[model samples]
Target: MSQAADRLALGRIGESVRREDATPKVTGEFAYGSDLSAPGMLWGRTLRSPHAHARIVAVDVAAAVALPGVHAVLLHGDVPGAKAYGLEFPDQPVLAGDRVRYYGEPVAIVAADGPERARRAVAAIRVEYELLEPVVDPARATEQPPLHPDRPTMRHGYREDPRPNVIRHLVIRHGDPDVVGDVSVTGVYELAGQDQAFLGPESGLAVPDGEGGVDVYVATQWLHVDRAQVAPCLGLEPEQVRIHLAGVGGAFGGREDLSMQIHAAMLALYTGRPVRMVYDREESFVGHVHRHPARLEYEHRATREGKLVCVRARIVLDGGAYASSSTAVIANSTAFAVGPYRVDNALLDGTVVYTNNPPSGAMRGFGAPQVCFAAEAQMDRLAAALGIDPVELRLLNALAPGDRLPTGQLLTGSLPTAEVIRRAAALPVPAPEPLPRDPLRLPGGAGNTTHGDGIRRGVGFAVGFKNICFSEGFDDSCAARVVLRADGRAEIHCAAADVGQGSASVILQVARTELGTDDVVLAPATTASVGSAGSTSASRMTWMAAGAVRDACREALAERERTGGADVDVEHVFRHPQTLPLDPETGQVTGARAHVALAVAAMRVVVEVDVDLGLARVVWVGVAQDVGKAINPRSVEGQIEGGIAQGLGHALMEELVVRDGRILNASFTDYLIPTALDMPPVTIDLVEEPEPDAPYGVKGVGEPPTVVSTAAVTSALRDATGLLLARVPVRPEDVALGSR
Candidate 1:
């Protein structure tokens, strides 16, 4: 074909194509980060603080050093340059120093011949500690002393009150606060702590480069950030600590913070041998950060006609013991406190407090999911009190194009909250049949308790929306290189972590259509080829990476057209629009780089609750999300289906139970996530609205199902039991006792 014809026939942004990673993932052949291993690599382990809050009185590393096969033991004294480091704040010690604030806080590390030897070495080390009072609750954080004095309430680090336990404080004010309405709904919502429950625990290998530097291979989200954090503690230059992402099992924001990176690197550098560290299931909970548990107080005032007039919210997130992404999480939680609705006046004050609990940081939903549950549930309550159809009421307040968010950032592109919710609600409802005296498909599903006797049914809907890309303008971006090879295939080089979201597949599908090649090879992502694609959180990778990959492909095609070549490769970067910092005092206008990517809104859950047993079964979960354009319709469906399943688990069965700041259910057997047998077949309605700015018009599909599913299930439980059901994974006693 002629160059002109080929250029004209190139796939535009909305076509469908095959994903490159589909085969490997499904066949169980893909190697996750934990699967990575090195020859003669030593295993590593960490000795943690038994007391949640304690002062380090003394440490005797001699016992551990004397142990056979123990190669190295490292601690804060071993740290070369920076004593503390964090994603946004340099408040958390890489290894605990003068004091330990959480039970899982690492004070010492050990590397040996095997994971068992490393574990035993840790037991041998004697550490003297003076116990301090543990602050377990975020609400009680302000009254107590702070965990770190360096971090304060405001953006000006120097101006903050030297109080304990307040890492980040954010306030957002929008419009005239003078606006008020007579009818209002005020309530406090409590969100429990969540674990990523990522199947593979943290694993990494630090291979010395024969220089003073080391090449660290690990499963992580941000390659650059990990390097930046690890290098400072190791007292090495940033370039010296080369971070390579290994095959990740599933991060879900758990791997966002450093787990085994620096420890393994330090050991490898000291021993002059490759060192590897992998966390056991129990160790995984202590090894990584969990999702912040939140307490939110929401006051919503609306006109009698259901027009949102004013909103006042105070959100307190439990940033357990460290300042890991606490600043960003607080900003997001407060900024979107009113949800994706049109509120004329909003006073949102959010606080992230340090507590001697398990460390919490970025999760898939960032700070938005916790707020979404409260906001949407409040919407339901408002609808009930005002006698408005919940669907119609939501549509009235849904933020459309050109809407100004609570953060004062204008919502751009296809803001389809109204369309998405409507489509989801329009799905045909399932009719329940009168089961015979014998019951096979009841709540317990073939279990003897599956009897239909005490079952009560209710359908509930929740409309949830989240900002797609990283907000507040940190210049968060991604880089991708697309090479159309002579083998009649296209290859995408991007370091965007998939985290089991199939971003690699999505990128391949985008490439296949763009270059019109069926055989698409997605090169294993590495920092060598692509620039930092940022973390896979915030649902941005699909949009940002695809934009870069497609742009590079287009550039390659243009170059090939001019040079008359069949194969061409090009690379490009996709940066999100920039955002500004929030004004400290008045919470007035601050420049924000907020752009709406693709809103994959979802509505879920019809359920039957046996109020007697506090046992509830989801009858079905119906989801509606705008994929903008499905590059691969099948994969798009997979994302929605998978996200809903995860959300279902969060709503009904998943939580990391922490007692006295210690994770009680770290293993899968104790801390239950959903199995296929646990989930109902999710009914999905694909709402296709082509996003003008995205490549192939594809909207983000991984997060919205998760965003909306929890609320829907919780809402359904409320309807079934006629109880408030304020918390998730509803307890049987609550249903049986008819507790509110």
Candidate 2:
């Protein structure tokens, strides 16, 4: 085939090739980590502290060790090497040491021949706890005793304050500090902690490699990071710990932190046999970190004509017992506190405080969703005061390519904020469904509690933007190797985790597109073979993986041309354009290179409120997103749909109920998620303006949809009820009763 013909053949980049795992996933034939098994494998179970805050008087594992089927029982004292491991900070104890700071803290592990035996051994272990007052309130967490008295300085030296509970305090002061507008709206908003609630519970299989090494098969976001953190704890070198990606059912940032990785390895090594650990539904809730429940006090000042003048915000996130990624979360919250609107003057202070609540870390939308709720609500309020349409109000102040952020970083990527908002707002609204609305269509759905009395409809609009990759000077890079096979197929190998995000497919697409070949093979993701692709979080997998694959394929193609069709292999570590660290005190970025790229999304939500019942039903959601480029339009749309679903869940029903630092509802029966019946129809408008700096001009597509959808849904609820709904997971009580 001629080069010109090959170029015209649409190899794969834009085509929505069927996801390789879709059939097996749908048919229940795909093997996840939980499905893994091995001969003579021991089952591991953890003994958790019942008390939220307590001094560990004693941990007697004697009885557990003596159990009939128990192969080994371990305590903090039994750890052969490092006793603590964390995502960003090595502050959390692998096994509770002298005290337990939060409920469900792992205290002991039991390895036995069977799960039942493991459970029995775990029950046999005795622990005596002296209950202590739990520091449940994030507002006062800093005033309480330090969760980590010897907490070390953060990796980048961002926190040198020596404060006990405050992980990081980032302040953004841009333009005039004290600028009050003629019209202003001030409100305090609260967001409940949300669970990633991924379908596959945290599970993994760890096998002793017989030579003082461990091989782990697990579902995780970043295998290399897991190995880096797990290796030292296991008293082994980094190369001694190998991780292979087990099929992940779903990981919306839930699998970023270490769960059973080290524990499974320790058990396997101790028992001299392979070991498997799986968290049940209830344990899964406590085993992993949650979305930081936030309290945001926001004051938006605008000109009488609905132009944004300034935004002042204080965002406090409940770090919850450990600093998984709280520092980064706080930075994101502070950076995007003002949402997508352009404001000349802004003052923002964001803090993540350590509390004895469930550990809070990464979730879909990261920290942006919480602030987006507050900022967008403020936009609506400001519009009401100015007597202007909300959409028009956002358009008047929508950020463009040259607008500066509160953090002093200038927007240089494909923002297209105004275009997104305009396109979403222009989409035709669907007519309300006919009356005698299926009892299934009512707020209570099949419950039939509502007779459609006092039903009112409302519409709300919101727009939000988030930095694409790791920011604030984190060295982020991905490595990929492309092999041009003699069989006329291109093979791509990268440690980038698929994580059910179609990243593997995206890699294949990029390889086929760059090499102009219809066939491409994806090597399994493993840390033992390839270099680090960094964490799959931050919606950076597609961008990083595709860029690396494209670059490596380009190099391999050149070699193949030189060798005249002989097999060629090339590896490339694709680095994103450099980003500088922010000024710690001022939270300001000086250079134009603070973020790899940026993506914006606009959403319009339609909701109906049953005023008497206080139940709300989302009618439809229309969204326009600046994806930069659609490498695979189907996958991009799927991402938007999935993100919107999670966002809708957060806006209406998803909350991890915590009381006095203990999760009250950990079971799925109690913790509600959206069902298919609850999902509203979504209409999406694709804004494919290419990002000049991104791979194939593609930007991160997974997170922006979620960033704005939550705000839009809740805004609609506020509009329908005519009430200032200042919190999320908006309860029926907030909108029900004698109509607001």
Candidate 3:
């Protein structure tokens, strides 16, 4: 083979190639956004509200402005442009002007010469507030006073609902709503708010260009969206504000909403000097939006043969103070309420309400995990009532190609629901250990909490699916520019955030595979360099980026051939098939589809529980996922394992304890996440069924594991204790007290 051919074979698609930043990240040489700095840069800090709901009586920043080394102190009146900005709705104030809706809402900002000086200046600022009762309960939100009385009606997709404190309300009616089956089960499940808990906190550096323009280097999921939201608040043209993607630690949808980007830029522009802002661990918890806490009530009906007949569900999600992506999140929750089962008659209602709780937005699993827990639990109950195996019941009702979902959108993509179910069920179960085993293998590892005296073993299975890309008529597209130099090296430019999910490596691999050469490099992601690649949430980056890069590479190659192989530069915009918004009344798609594609996964978990002590330990987990294709097998496996760890955390011990809209556990010391020792042995099986419309037939691999594993773990717990276990992060008190 020629030298070029050898190089082409080095890191082609489907190979387990190493990540480009793996060594730097592991060696602590990586520079995250929090490491950003500049000469003579001032530190920025925010003064937050201590009350969940209160009316601002007066603002007093005179002391803060007079403090030594304080460069600038800004209030809401100082905002030159728009006062509010959000991902979906412009409701959240950049700085609270009149009323504070949630605890920790930014009330003022300060920039000083040092971190300590900034903190001292922020402490000097004082604002008088008139305390008001907060609306903290989602169930009673509609009955309370309107949070935004000026905008009593909120629009979701093509529909609008005129309800107080409601962000979005959607209803899905399909087939006959009165249909009933021989066997039925009903259950109510609840899930607490979960934090993204990314290692790097919200940080950014902003520098003034001395030309009424500013450059912002920040950790975020979408650069274009950030620029779009930031420019208006600064009273500058969109082109005047340039957003450069800084090194991100992790963003499982946490960075999708604005954190410190606007505040840092505002301070820098106001002071006419560079400004750097970094949040500590406690502030980081309150800075970013968390996953929506949900209340799901589901009823599943089946015939004597265990085939799903109908599903009726009511899902209420607490969207918190502002509408980040609550409209879309509620749509996802309502659309996929029945899990991956085939149900002919369905009636679903999903409502996301504004409350005094912390704002909730995107997470790893979007809105699917909350409903999956309830749907799967109901499935198990139906199986028990009908005397059928759990896995067998799921396989019988698994969604097949050409089947219609509850939204009436046909499943045309590669959805191997049954394939994954069977594969997961076929995996070998872990061998049972004898009593009085090693202390480290007990329920509470290294804690010596149990001696295996009251241990009970159990196994459980669950399946779930979610939409791949932005749905409900959102125009989703990605643009890439590829330049092939005369020296036979190529450079690919695309504004797709890596977000620690390894999309940078996937882009490089796709460029190499399509160009048939390994001499490719990725340019830094920035708003000035490339067009929108959309947000990194919704598990769409791999599919969107691969398509954009492949098209751009092929176009560059064609241009080079036409120019006698001198040099070529080309850009291409790749878009999926257009989807339509759901009908307001019927909740059915007006066009052929309402979603771009679908991905499904299944998992089986083995758990050992101590009934007396109310503790549980997951021994093994088996996962089977439909990946369409693995652009990089190693990265895919890593994503699956990481997602499972998060799911396990939510299932067993992760919750942001909030009382009366005040977060109790705002730091890692109180809020728990899964460590290496807490993770079980996860066996992953990739079902590569190439999607017809996707480039290389690759489906997203991040969300499915998270969507199903939580339900599977909870199922195992129920089996062990013979309890309903309708809530997540099952507390020891609940288990020991036998309370649902």
Candidate 4:
């Protein structure tokens, strides 16, 4: 054994190997959570309140119990140990108790022979409600009573507050805010609520043992957390309740928290039969959390020469009814408010309010996407005021390899803002042409409402970054157990959920690369073997799970190199370096707490807008991104393309329509997403500058495209209309109003 073979190890680190799971996924043989079935499993359904906010006066489950197929009906009183649970705070009720916060909030569950019977039985169950005032606006949360008490109305933990709807507050004060600049631009931006829109709805199966314990087969991001929450709710020990990872369609941070696991387990334990729960499209929208809707008031000051001077921002986030990661989300939104730029003076205040909107938690971009739209927009506005190129303005403030973030954490990794932007801007813009008279590709879209009208085109530039893995001092680690069999094969065991990010395949690739063996299998992720892989979020699993796999494989290889002489297999965990907590006053970190994936993106959008009908159609889009190290350059480009499509949807078409605290348009039919025909011809420019800190210097590649593309598309629209469309999902009326 010599250094030559060791160089082979380094060779495998950066090459793009074929994804192990690709064939089955493309062939449609891939099984998702909805595809799971078991013998003698009863279908579970939950009854929800029709009212947005109401008091639970009384409940009558006798009718549902009398139904022939109905085996069990469980109420709030049936919860075993904990009545409320949340990812960040214990504010959300597992079952509706004295009050219901939002419409569609689960109140009771029914287990029956089939899904239809369960639905019927759920309909038969009657619950009397005393309708209450619903606090629909976040601006009013401070003046309104919270659905979940601000303090000890339920469980008290590390921190408690005697307050109203405010769940958490994060204020970052950096350089003196009193510093004045030669020129400044002030504006406010609004971001609407965005849904995860994962292709698969929520589905799971829970089998209760006759001995008062249960086992759950569910679609989730973290199996351990699901086990923890369900064990307490079902009145069982953690050891008694085992969780197996079911097939996932896509998570994108939506499935990070508990969904139907508690309800299914509770029903199964009470009914003594395996219960299966599958949410319909509307129910899925109601069952899971959405991204936070925000109102950001931002002011940016810069020298006339384009050097960033100071930044002041006030970000108010609507947490909806319960505190679900709202505290951490506010910290994320406010702390990164200045974006991947260097600002000397900064003063920021972020407050999350508990209103009767649908509770918002983790989405793909987390909190950073919201502020990026504001911060990047400010940069564009400032560039216009100073007559500097938008790209040049950003490059002037672009953080370098050793710059300090507004949070005061040193930017240790690649901060290629200028690099990414310059290359992205150099991308070839699409050729423009006059609007066609053809009826099909008209401005009103498939509806064929407008054939020809006033049309304009515009281009925009944007830069954004999201933390790659978990931060804020959380013990974010992954466990990979690589078992070497006598037959010269390997098996990788870990609970890293594959929610369409290709983490499963990536994990296998990492193992293959490290072990230098092609014969390897990634055992299905289950709580039975591996520890928590955190959530398939923050675009972390690719690096986190891959890191774990490589570590375990490397250990096995090391052991073989020492004793087995080249055929040894072992298992181990790969934990990232620990992060330090952020300082309260200056928002500076006393230690290493910041981790990010930054991508500077630019898009040239051509559109045909009917000023009369206020309908616009995007003609084409061009993009460029820095992926650090494209482990799979092809796959990375695909992800960037798909992310841009979703971002375009957010800019021009996608929004969750909530009224009176109820999600109105919950289905794809009503809530429009982009289709293939809706997607314009996309051209992508890829850059490779490996992140030194990342595994193999591979930067996280999932969320950065999503973070920047939305603002770029919206910026183009603003350029065309000459009117600032401050809000997203720009409506048709907005264009018509601008035409006036």
Candidate 5:
């Protein structure tokens, strides 16, 4: 091919093209939301409740208002319009007025000339509270008095339980509820709350437009959703609130909810000056929702021949305080209760209840990670009881096309469960390194704690799947506008937040491929520029953005052809196949499907444990993921690697210690995450099975790795320890002591 032709194909589909922001990010030239500022900007700070649950007797902001640099001291009553806001349910208070439901709930806001002054003003505000007993346990949340009694009872068109503090209770009775297997294995598992821990804290700059409107430059997942939720609270029309996506350092699902967006906008509008709000490290921990800590009791049954029979599970998720996306989280937990397997019968009860714990909502895998850990552990137990290999057992019952989920949603998309399992299993395992070689490579790296004493190596495998797009009748769609310049370059406009998952690169690649040009530019993501590209979550950005960009490019090309090679601009909205809501009573799909697509992943984790010290180190991870298609092979690999790192944290050391609804370890010094030294070498096999219904046969790839990697790591830990470790963030003491 000529050099010209090669240049045109530089970033087409299937190529490992460089990320658009890679250079800027690596060179330290990238500006995140925290870097946002404007002329005459005042720093905004929030005053949070110290108690978990408390009735506000009175809020005195006189001292705060009299503070030297304080410009505004506002309470809930000062809210221009709505007093409450949330992602799915408007139950969380914009500012706690009558009461505070959870610890760190915002009760008042302060704006000052500087960040220090704002902090001082916040400290000066006095709040008199009447302490109340917090509903700290999800299992007994319903028995407690109502936390949100006046909130609506309906969610996603399903009536919630009338019981107090019950967010959503989903029951799935598939096949025979009374079916019995020749052999059964039961176990109880617990998952601790995990934080998104994105590098950039929640921050935003709200500049009031002179015309009774505001422009919010913030780090958020969805610009349109932010506008939708912020406008009502500001007593402004939707058009009056414009949201622009600032550079996001990372948002595994943390930016999906309101943090400082509304508060900053309110301060900006009230003061008529740019208001900048940024959560410090400590405040960031309390400002956002975490992964729902769960308790799962699972029983897996199988025949003596190693074929699966039935699965029975009771899953309870602690959706702390308010309903952010707890209803949908519970739905996912129930739908995927039985991993990526075909079971003849299943009886699953999944409930997410209100608690005084930190609010739990979208985190990487949503609710699938918690359930996958439990289900995979039960699968291992069943395998042990049936005297079968874990990989063989998984392969025997791996979900295939045409198989129906527990929710009765047929697998019409690409779900290469068995293939991924086989591929992951076939990957060559790393040979054990010679002992007394490098202390840095051991379980307690560089600690010089041991000289390879009591070291044991173990290997384990896990396979899991997750739904691709938003499910349960959400109008999942993306819009893109393509303008073909007379110079033959193309500009693609879509409001899809990148969130550090390389969606911008994917969009650029798709536009270049469709328009047959390498010179393509991406417009800044903003609500004012284009229609909603939905949220940069649920692993849906690539699929949705690609479809929208592809359609828009094609339309623009056709217009150009019609105009005899003149410049053309076209806009198009691409909608996924419609999904139906699940039946509230039976937990069955109301129509052909309840999810847009499904992706599967299989992982084999190898670990070395110091049995005496209770320390563990992951040596290797082999993953086979059902990507449907790889838009950028390198970017896909990065996603897989990043997900494995997060999963490793969950399996080994990422524990958000919450004691009675208070986060004990909110800082990085106490809450550990996987660093470069802790990460293992990852081997990946991308399974490209085309989903017939998807554009370019692509499925979302961000979530499946996280869904299964935690399970795989824990399986390895159990293999080495010979212990029934039922909980995650496996403490060193549990391994060192249990072994004795």
Candidate 6:
């Protein structure tokens, strides 16, 4: 193909293709996971431990088994094969056998004819527990008893000490670690645990095939991985367990980990009947993992002219109970610890430790957002110390193409860091309305807590970047099958889970663009139909899935041409360029690359603070992202807006409060997320700087908006209040109490 064709925009790639599931989703006709039901399906309920740390002394299921409506009562002994499962390591037990390490660890399960009956049976199942002191602090994890022993048998080749609770401790030393600059600023930032708070609760339906196998319909991020993990626990082969994707409400990384997938299948297989499990709002909070709460200490060194010299950071992540993708999270945090800036010398250490807190796993932005907050804060401090404009300072140090990351990976792809920052900073700020207007304009809004008595406005800026695909030698690939039908239409088959990131629409758009036909059909994502399309995560779906679809379509078209316009079917697996694992001692990746590509975002946030009432409201968010390409402009804008809203919630209100490792606010009434009123108006600048290797020059756009929005908002708050705010979900008390 010539360069002219590569530059041409045709079919649906750049057009705003209407979402296939939009109408059904908005009209309430879509059958989400919670809406799935089977005829004669029994309800499944799990009995969770009440104590965060306790010994399971005895379990008597006689009462539950005797219940008239109950079909099955299962305990630890009931697990037929594997007793543990996880994405990275099999550490979390299918059912707690001896001791429960977390407050909501599943101890037993009950299947009954109805939901209420299952709940009653769960209550009736007698279980005796001896309470133990909980290790709830990540800072003190090394002094606590070993959560998962650090022996050779348990270690999965990742570097770690024989400490009590440390899961992975990654150290990176690049350039001159001992380099000192003319000026230095140090700060410590703390981030709270945040929930995905997806609207749909975890739900699933499982039915026995009456042939020693089962069919499961569940809302999850990866169907093949679920099948692999569930089949082992059920004592069945992967083929025996067919997994289908139910309609997902939203994932945002919450559904990346297993939830009710196995429980529903276990009950269905044991009872010889269909089983359904739907977690209520309260149960959903404890059922899935939350974002890891992070504590980061950063020191930024720069010359008097505000030129960055060196950066050193120590990041600690609380990996509650089990190691679910903790190693990957730590790697990302360490790699992007210094933000999207050029640092000559750096020293970094990132660690994730086991504790009795609620389990923390994948969340939007992965682990980069936590460190971004700290790094951006340090940048602002440095700018203040150097007496320079924050935006100018960031622009001066912005990473560019050919720049080397702290991981030692050469930026061979597009690195528009300075461009993104410049565009964001140049966005026009919204003008203020007349005073004595609506009380809703105040921070307290209709509550009338403040009538514009002491409101002040400030603007702030931040930039963040992260690896676009799974890093560290993960075998990431996507399989696609394209069939050019006799009617000149194309059908695409792939098991890429659409967790509300518009992967389905993106796949169809890619097919239409490649096949040069508007009549493209996207098949439902299922493991029984296609090979693994990998997880819809790491912002790799668009690149991997679309690449596979394009490859398969090209083969199908070529075959059709060879056969004189006959129908042709082709299957292909799109593999990313190999990424190497980081060297343990030096923290540098030695191979060609550690990440496929990097996606950068810059944000300028406007915030209004009411010092008297200690309430703050984000006014506007101006975000500039280098997306390489926009498959659909509307969807890209929606993703950016949604991400900014979520990020704003993280900055101001969303916090999963825990006391002694127990979640205090599990329901929405207690936990706060950004409502429509809380979200600021987002203005997005889509910068098309295509990666030469990506399909259609597409880079990930989902996680970057979220990565820096929080920092920008926090920086604004600091500007308005003149206080060094070091913690997230900045409460009104923090603002009001520390008011100057």
Query: lDDT per prediction?
Result: 0.77, 0.87, 0.91, 0.78, 0.90, 0.89
Q: When superposed on Cα atoms, how far off is each prediction in RMSD?
A: 4.3, 3.6, 3.1, 4.4, 3.2, 3.9
Total clashing pairs in model 3: 0
Model 5 CA deviation exceeding 4 Å by range? 1-10, 151-156
lDDT of 2 at 682: 91
Q: Any runs in candidate 3 off by more than 4 Å, and if so which? A: 1-10, 152-158
What is the per-residue lDDT of model 5 for residues 602-677, given as tens digits with 9 covering 90 to 100?
A: 9999999999999999999999999998988899999999999999999999999988889999999999999999
Clashing pairs in 4: none
Give Cα distance to truth, residue 555, candidate 2, Å: 1.1
Steric clash count of candidate 5: 0
lDDT of 6 by residue, 341-427 (tens): 888799999989999999999999999999999999999999999999999999889999888889888889987999999899899
Error of 2 at 359 (Å): 0.4
Q: How do the predictions measure up, each by TM-score?
A: 0.93, 0.97, 0.98, 0.94, 0.98, 0.97
Sequence-dependent TM-score of model 2? 0.97
Tens-digit lDDT track for model 1 on 249-326? 877778888888888888899888889888888888777787788888888899999999999999999998877887
- Residue lDDT tens for model 2, 481-596: 88888879776779988888788778877887788777777777888768999999898888889889988988998898899999998889998889987888777886766677
What's each prediction's clash count? 15, 1, 0, 0, 0, 0
> Please, what are the lDDT tens digits per residue for candidate 3 over residues 22-43?
8888999888898889888999
lDDT of 4 by residue, 452-536 (tens): 6566667777888777777777788888887886578788887887776766667766777777777776677777776777777
Q: Model 5: how far is 176 from its true place, Å?
A: 0.5
The segments of candidate 6 whose C-alpha lies over 4 angstroms from its true place after superposition are: 1-11, 150-154
Better of 3 and 4 by lDDT: 3
